[model samples]
Target: MATCAEEVSKTKLVVAAIDFGTTYSGYAFAFQKDYSSDHHSLRIYGIMSKNGCSQKAPTCVLFNPQGKFDSFGYDAENRYAELTLTNEHQDWYYFRRFKMMLYNNPNITWHSILKDDKGKSMNAIKVFSAIISYLRQETLRNINERVANVGIKENEINWVLTVPAIWSDQAKQFMREAAKKAGIHSDQLDIALEPEAASIYCKHISVSRRERQETHGAEGVGLEAMCPGTKYLVLDAGGGTIDITVQRVQENGTLHQVYMANGGDWGGTKVDEAYEAFLEELVGQNIWEAFKAKYMDSYIDIFREFETKKRTISPDIENRITFTVPPVLRDVYEEMKNSPLSTTQGHHRNRKLIWKGDRLRVDVTEAKKLFETTCALIVAHVERILDKEETAGTSDILMVGGFSESPMLSNAIKERFGHTKRVIIPEEAGLSVLKGAVLFGFDTRVVSLRVMKHTYGIQSSSLFRKNLDPDITKTMVKGKLYCEDRFSKHVKKGQSVRIDEETQTIDYHPLDDREEMAVKVYITDKYDPEYCDTELCSYIGQLLVCLPMDVPTSDRGVKVNMKFGGTELSVRATVMATNQTTHAEFRLLE
Candidate 1:
């Protein structure tokens, strides 16, 4: 296992982190001097929400009709809502919950397109870049106006962006590209995995120790007090993804990965999806669709209300879940159906949905049902991770992220794992990622090790074997038969790796007389994949290895060195003849 320690650039005087979440987003920063002594040195920016000020505003952006950036966050939301009221939003682009585009997409490229609220499409990179740029400016403004006496130079600040641990390299790279477009230099930025950052933030928190001891006995010391070999699980349930990772504390006060992070799209947004489905069922699907189309402002309001209500909902609540239904919904429903919403076909059969002037009271049982599927998936996934051999010693469950604040989810986890492990929901669970990312920016080595989630390799030409290689992969190479698309694995799945460790150098020769070699990178779920074109294998990106044209094809060689220990994979290639070294830029889109 690779165990080299990693360090951030010492020239950086301050660390700033942007937690670009699916449902909400925020930024935090702390100076290097305040990192050790002052726990309250970290300053989290508060954005304006409908409820007033919050640590995070909704993750959203808006563009004017001229295709120029307008506003972001709650400001964008309020502006777009006003536009919708005046029927002026048709040409204006407003996007919300767009981070899911990266999660749901299998092929994310620089040119990937994102659709706005009205199904209008814009370049995905542009959309992401706009949000990141807004955050960057806001953070800099905060530091200049409130935190620092003198203006901080962009180069003097280390920028960190938090991504879900389960995200694909393409997604991570996409964020990097967006950050670059947003004016953050590649040398100054770091990608901190969501669960890993949360774990680091929890590591310094001592207030939860008493609660842990009282809840799960003496063995359940807080993460701050964890012994050298103590193992804990981090469940980062965000709006878009439930990222879970098992961590083991090392003797040096660093953390090692017990298991790779894993989870799915079953998050807080899943509950939103379920609620929308329920609404569609209660009101006729066509009517509901019409309502969303014509009453965009009201539709947004409904979900904003749902977002607030989702956090407070509990399994023990007896009273009905009262949602303040906007008057526009009722008006549109009656206008479209030529009758009151209560007399709808679906509502007539279900007495659980009570409609009273602008107030839609849903049975508590029904409201709780919306959470069942998502909560079940999260609970089951954690159970499966705990059952794994690598995580056998883990006895503490550290919950963090915006969705972890849900009482329903908190209760479900405790009810299931309380007897076996201590379930900890740290204070301000939502800000853990934002705050932890700032800490990660200060010290990249906080997470000293990580487990590989996939077997990573390069596609190369190999000597064809009659039985082992398929006939389709056979090709003539200098009168000798060779197999194309062979997987040359550098790192196997489940291998432990350190942040600074590089894979063993693998030398390769040009398959053809081409001047440059395409070092095609591939990843697979299988431990030992044979062919790069297999169903389980995915083509991630490729690096162009430039070979000296003066050298003969037979003499051309490049030594490939790959590093998969960090959040992103990096490649370095050294030419054999000139001894010239070049780094590979994994091009995702073309």
Candidate 2:
């Protein structure tokens, strides 16, 4: 009925976003037609599990003894539990909440080793690739079911992977390589900064404004309430890290970052750790260890229940919060304490511990204290950002993340900043990053500007000056005096970089008679440095350029270009003689 060209032109553009979080992971996508007509209708969904439909799946992976991926998410948890029953889990690799490894790793690379829960080590790239592959397959199946008679092609779809804005370039590149191994082409993949993605999605959605106005005052309801150039702060509190950034809205609905992205490991999972510590303190450490070893399924169950309860807890709640204790843990506690867990024992000796059926009830005040450690850190970081000179005039705070859904956290933030700034928590704050990533895939230019996290540059030689430069860096090249380790800055720290902005071009020549040149890329926190060996500076990666075989050493000069505006750094080198150009493959230092 239609020509091949017509049929080809009818191919749809689908955007799929994979939000790989530290404690959880999920995928969300939208068809271009649906997103363009009405952005509000584009509801982001995640993989369904037997337990229920959730916005994210637990970021847990289970691999067999052969080092092959067995299952992921709840399935992985269930499989590991089954294996634990037979004492076979020791040989299998089970990784859970492992995404933070990249963030904490100072020298993250593609060849890094990731240790699992049992201390079993595997290639980080393989581990990430397996998880990404599972998500991709599951998402593709879901897409097939959603659309009828409209077959999707890989080229027609754009994929966006979300990464923490605070992560280093090596970490981001590691994710990119892992995605490529999972079958996504490098050209089709776009990396989205978590906080920026969340901001973009919240900017378009009006529900947050409507809900805020209905609950709080009508002032500072949404982006529409503020005039153009008005600034606001976005706090993306996830399971592993809380990233904060200040951004101003542009006239064309674009966004510009006002401050560099910053935050720490104070996230929702910190509260879980506090709760676990409470149990360890309530019962002796030996008993707690035994309980964990013998009743891991029960341990997971307790936390799973706590996860649900934690979200609903508010500072105003009068009743004591209760959690179901596994029978085995209860037995262990009794055996260790030599008495039953009740109101008159352990840390809360004066308070009454109500035992309703198999559940342990704790006072609301005690339960609320568990959240204080993490919530306090979040508030402190937000205040620090607000105190910065760059964040001046920021009157609104947009809180989005799984942790932001916690009633206690919301109230704490509101109580602290309610007088000076309006706090807006969007509905389903957990899915904001995933959905916003999908929006980013559709249009990467939504975030018009970003602040450079670090000063990126290359190590090159410059003519050594007697008075201006140090003697240690002086070297002789081709009988010419030079500073061998001179820091050639491509982008300075805290510089405002617009989307697609390219760094200034610099010319480089082969150091030796060899026909190849190596460009060493380095990053530092210092404002400006004369040498790359300064404090807080580290070598990240290198780019190799090969000259034509017949070209002379003098003609082997290459023009190097670097771009630091996006989530990752990009480098391109062109031979000056033949005009041949090639993208540099950055190899991270081991």
TM-score top scorer? 1
Alpha-carbon TM-score of each model against the true structure: 0.93, 0.92
Candidate 2 residue pairs in clash (backbone atoms < 3 Å): 343-353
Please write out the lDDT profile of model 2 over residues 1-590, one tens digit for every residue: 00111123234378888999987899977887877788666765544444653568899999999999999998898888888777778889999888988889988866799898767899999999999999998888888778758877778877788999988777888888899899987777888899999998888774485456756677776434445787999999999999888999999888999899989998898999999998787667899998877676777788888888888889999997887777778788778778875543234546456664567888898889999988898898899889999999998899998999898898889999988987888888988899899877777777888898888888998889998888998999889889888999889999999867778999987778765677787898887877887767888888676665668877878888776766777667888898898545566635
Model 1, span 56-138: residue lDDT tens = 88998999998899999878988888887778889999999989888889898867999998899999999999999999998
What's the lDDT for candidate 1?
0.83
* Overall lDDT per candidate, in order of appearance: 0.83, 0.82
In model 1, the number of clashes is: 0
Model 2: lowest-lDDT 10 consecutive positions: 1-10
Clashes of each: 0, 1
Candidate 2 — which residues are off by over 4 angstroms?
1-12, 43-50, 207-210, 213-227, 334-352, 355-357
Q: Residue 20 lDDT in model 2?
A: 96
